[model samples]
Target: MNNGKPAPYDARVITHYGVLGLGFFPQVYYYWYKWLDGRYVGTAARTVVKKLLLDQFVLTPPLLVVFYVSMSVMERKTDLFEECRNKLLPTFKTSCIFWLPAQALNFLWVPPAARVIYVGTCAFAWVNILCWIKRQDY
Candidate 1:
């Protein structure tokens, strides 16, 4: 097993990314629209940007941290920090890849009800990917 080290693929990169994708992609569109709308008012744009930054960068990370802790607890045992560090970058890349087009479709063309289509489709695939990852042995 490659000098007894866990190779990169040994971790579930796609699943990790998919999970993060749940939050990140949705917010991108949400905030982008908010920003566009807020620009009309002087301070509103700055306020919106600050709030978005806080929500996206500061708040969500802690939420994920909590989720990680809960996941470890619920499962009875696991290295949460290690998993977070190892999977973070891959997850970021995966979100970037999947989120771009999803957002494009959701924000640009789809009506309100149709927005759920992208979420449902992507979320389902992500859930399935995570399920598959859980089934595999490291």
Candidate 2:
């Protein structure tokens, strides 16, 4: 039973998920923006839509898998994918709901140089959502 309370702050967990997980995000965001800019050229509407689709369908799924698998490894779970199997769909669904608009705004309004920082800010809230979802059983 989770008791619906967040886990106590643990430095190891923070280090792994926060520091390590986020460390790579800037580069990923930079490249993602660059790729989108290079690949999709035309109307802003078309670009934003394509960016959202790639983000929601392509980037998010693998990222969720990495999150679950990494958390499982960090926790020393016996079955690495058990939590992933249970949680992946729900997490991805929630991610789509959350990220689609956020990324659209990112692609549309936010400047390229600031996209990483913008995403990091958005991630603060998204991380909380992820933590809540991770804590839930189903």
Candidate 3:
């Protein structure tokens, strides 16, 4: 069923966001950031360190797991868990490499109001990757 076709188009498109949750993380990051750093001397320095490194490190692991698993299930893979296992590490490693600089720039420059849109916009490239990952024949 990983044929780039889903019984329903809505479900298919939304599934790319099964793990990513369209706007959820951005909202979470936006709100949750304030609570994290305890009275940092400089806001700019805190935003850079906290947003770039801490957020990514904490979210990446669980996000990868949900992404692989949800994607496999959404694609209707017969071996759902197997598909997740096969793709998890590879995709996660790639995401780590790819998102590091992207997030750094995001935190450094992009305004909080636009961060969700920023990450979601960046996720277009990731959508291509998801397309390829799900396209694999099992």
The lDDT per prediction is 0.50, 0.84, 0.66
Per-model TM-score versus the true fold? 0.46, 0.86, 0.65
Higher-lDDT candidate of 1 and 3 = 3
Cα deviation of 30, candidate 2, in Å: 2.5
RMSD, each candidate, Å? 9.5, 3.6, 5.2
lDDT sort, best first:
2, 3, 1
Model 2, TM vs. native: 0.86
- Candidate 2 lDDT at 80 equals 98
Which candidate leads the pack in lDDT?
A: 2
lDDT of 3: 0.66
lDDT of 2 at 68: 92
Instruction: List ranges where model 2 is wrong by over 4 Å.
Output: 1-8
